[model samples]
Target: MEEIFDECWNSKGIQVFVKRDDLIHPIISGNKWRKLKNYIQTFSLNEHSGILSFGGAYSNHLFALAFVGHSLRIPTVGIVRGEELIITSNPYLNQMNDWGMRLHFVARSLYRDKEIPSEYENYLCIPEGGYGSQAIDGMDNLVHELPSCDAIYCAIGTGATAIGIARATSVLVTGILTLNNRAEIEDHLKDFPAANLKLDDKYIFGKYAKSNADLETFCRDFYEKHQIAIEPIYTGRMFYALVDHIKNGHIAPDSKLVAIHTGGIK
Candidate 1:
């Protein structure tokens, strides 16, 4: 955890700190590492033929998993969400391929089934965004590393990270939703106490992977001011929401808040 003393926070009479989970690793950083920890530990490389997971074209989950598979010498398959990515080559997909993760593009419809095709049934199947019972255990580990605060904030994709943190700690967990609806997140976190969790969808900036000029400008200015780079998909939206909450008096005066930098800048 790193304390960032900015005049913006001082003006609001709030103390702000960022948990630098992004610096945990170069590739498998932030919540990605936390979410994948138990799964990787439980499954032995020799026991399984390969590992299979689901994600979109620009998914940080796929990107991190590719590097993980390469480092562990495990054969990996990424069930890509869009079939168009097969013909269109981009840096993210190219890097996943280079890292030895076999790309299997599927139509968006079939991807929703969340099951490995019969041919790859033998491989270990990991859910989209790494949400599972094991993921909660893995993410619960993050609570131990965090400092006591009035509230904790993080970007919510699958809600696994926020739910895990909420379950493990008494601090109010504010999850800035990167998606359009909170229904999916609410469903995933149904087992947890609702009073401990707060979900906000106001900072999505249109939709996942979509950004506008204001968001871009804010990220640029934030980097110049704090020297911490945040991408639009996760961290940028999270910080944007945090600042907005503080400025609008949503966060109580003099309250300490810790924002989890969930990485995936690339």
Candidate 2:
């Protein structure tokens, strides 16, 4: 937990701190570790053949999973979305393949339905982007890792991290939506009726994984100022929204905000 001094928030009399989950590790850092912690803990080789998960060609989740599988000496399978993508499509995919994760490319049509191949029925299949009850349960400890603050900020991917933090704390949890998944996120929040979570999609900047010049500029400027790395996809939109809110007087004065740097900087 590090307190960040920025003129936008400072001028408004709001204290801003960033929970640097990105520094948790070089590979399995940030919410990747948080979301997968329980899945790894509950897995037993005797009970299950291996772990299977879904992702795209450059999925950070799959990359981290592959590393975890290699480190734990557990068999792992990754059902890649694009059938055209292969093990050598990109360096990230190549690294995941090198880590010994069986890369099974599936048709985009079938991947949409999240159909698990019949041969891996025995494997424990984590949902795409690690968004499931287990992943949400895995993030239960996020609140304990924070300093006292009035609000918590985090980028919503599977909605697990923000919801997990909201469930664990009474403070306001503001999730900046990086994509157009408000309904999906709301569905995930149904199980947690008392969660103090708010979803903001204003800063999506068109769609997920899409970056424009302004976003790139903010991310670059943010790094120059704070010396903390944040990519435009996840953490960038989050901090951008946080700064915008403070600058527009949306955040109350004297409010202490903690932003979770959920680590997408590969």
Candidate 3:
């Protein structure tokens, strides 16, 4: 896996590094691999009929799981959180379909009640963004494999990896929230035992998967300058917030900040 340190080096004064978890496992790179590691290991491919998970149309978790299941010769199902619609030959969805993942659509209203759904009986109910206890269990290995650093930063969607990372290390964990659903995220993290996890909701462009011109420009220029592809969903926001924090003197010069590159470079 190529670790593009160039993106972090542009801070002028701040010394930043990115833990390229996105490159750890090819198709299953980043947090999705961490979140699904245990789940994948526990069952034999022949034991279960298929693996089922939830996601939005463009979800990296869904894409990763589809690839993993297909490679392992396991049937997969995706409960997409939207109204049923025809899927075109877009790169991401096309790849998932090529991998033979059965895509199912649910009403956005029904998706909000995911936890108590009666449809989850036979399927392994992996939540959206791969949150919950299983994901935290898998993410426990993320920071432990890295060198000691002053702070570890990542973008927060479901808040599972942040909680797990903070719990697994003494380093300060700062999460940039991509969702306006901070209070809801906080409520979800109540059971997790992470000591130094902090959430910043200000960097969220508007809502999940949404971005503004500043972010778009930053992503384009950052990729052009460093040749590292970053999608707006997670890594882009983390990169933006990290640079802004350094520029604003929020990060100390002596601090060794490591950002988790949970990659989905679309």
Candidate 4:
């Protein structure tokens, strides 16, 4: 888990150091690996029984959980948000199904609270993005990877990673919100003891995982310029925002910024 801090001297004279968390692990890496580590350690997982929970479709957590649970010989279940959709062309859902995760799709509204039926109460339910106390414990340990940094920047999804990092580290954190639900994020972060948490509302391209031509171009140019691959869902937007913030002189030149690259480049 060595953090890469190499400076890329590009042709355009733009210098950037890439922390390649994408190379963390083949099946489980980045934030997902760190978040799941404690859960696997603390819980006594049997040969064919464990509960993993997440959204209906396009959930990175569900995908990662299915992969890890299967590898560890634990039978997993994904408590998805929203009613079941028609069985058609859905790559994400189909992939999870192939991975042997029991997909349970409930009403979108109820999925938020995750009040499961009485019959299934015994299962070890892992919340979306593995939030709650367990996730905080795992993320708090992530500081061991980077003991010293002036600031940390990570993409904001459910705010789990941000909250965990903010809770774990004393360094200033810049969480780039990637969705329109700012109020929800603020509400979530309120639970943490905030000493260095700084939420920025500028990077969310008006929607979650939605990108305009400029963003797309930035993604393309970023790869072409630095050979660092970033997904549009999380890391791409955060990296772009970081570059923008630097260009705007928001971060001092002397201050070292460590961008947490949670691998989602699928």
> Which tens-of-lDDT digit does each residue in 1-266 have in candidate 2?
88889877787789999888898899988999889988999999898899999998878899889999999999999999898987889998999889999999989999999888899999999988887777777777778878888998999988888888888888999999989999988887787653589889999999888868999999999999999999999999999999999888889999999999998544
- Clashing pairs for model 1 are none
Prediction 4 TM-score vs. true: 0.87
In terms of TM-score, the best-performing candidate is: 2
TM-score of 3: 0.89
Candidate 1 per-residue C-alpha lDDT over 1-266 given as tens digits, one digit per residue, 9 for 90 to 100: 88887777788679998999999898899989999989899988667788899998888898899999999898899999886777247888888999999999988888888768788888998899898888878877788988889999999998888888888888898999988868888777666555688889999888787857888888898899888889877888899999998878798788999999988836
lDDT tens per residue, model 4, 1-266: 33333243222233344456677786576777777777777767543247767765677778788888778777788877768653243777777777787787788888878776665566687878877767766776666676466788888887888888888878898889888877987787677666677888788888887757888888788788667777777888898888887667677655666788888625
Q: Rank by lDDT, highest first.
A: 2, 1, 3, 4
lDDT of 3 by residue, 96-129 (tens): 8889988777889988776433554666667787
Q: Give the number of colliding residue pairs in candidate 4.
A: 0
Evaluate model 2: give its TM-score. 0.97
Model 1 deviation from native, Cα RMSD in Å? 1.4
Question: Which segments of candidate 3 are over 4 A away from where they belong?
Answer: 1-13, 45-47, 115-120
Write out the backbone clash pairs for model 2.
none
- What is the Å distance of residue 61 in model 3 from its true position? 0.9
C-alpha RMSD values across all candidates:
1.4, 1.1, 2.7, 3.3
Model 1 TM-score is: 0.96
Candidate 2: where is the Cα deviation over 4 Å?
none
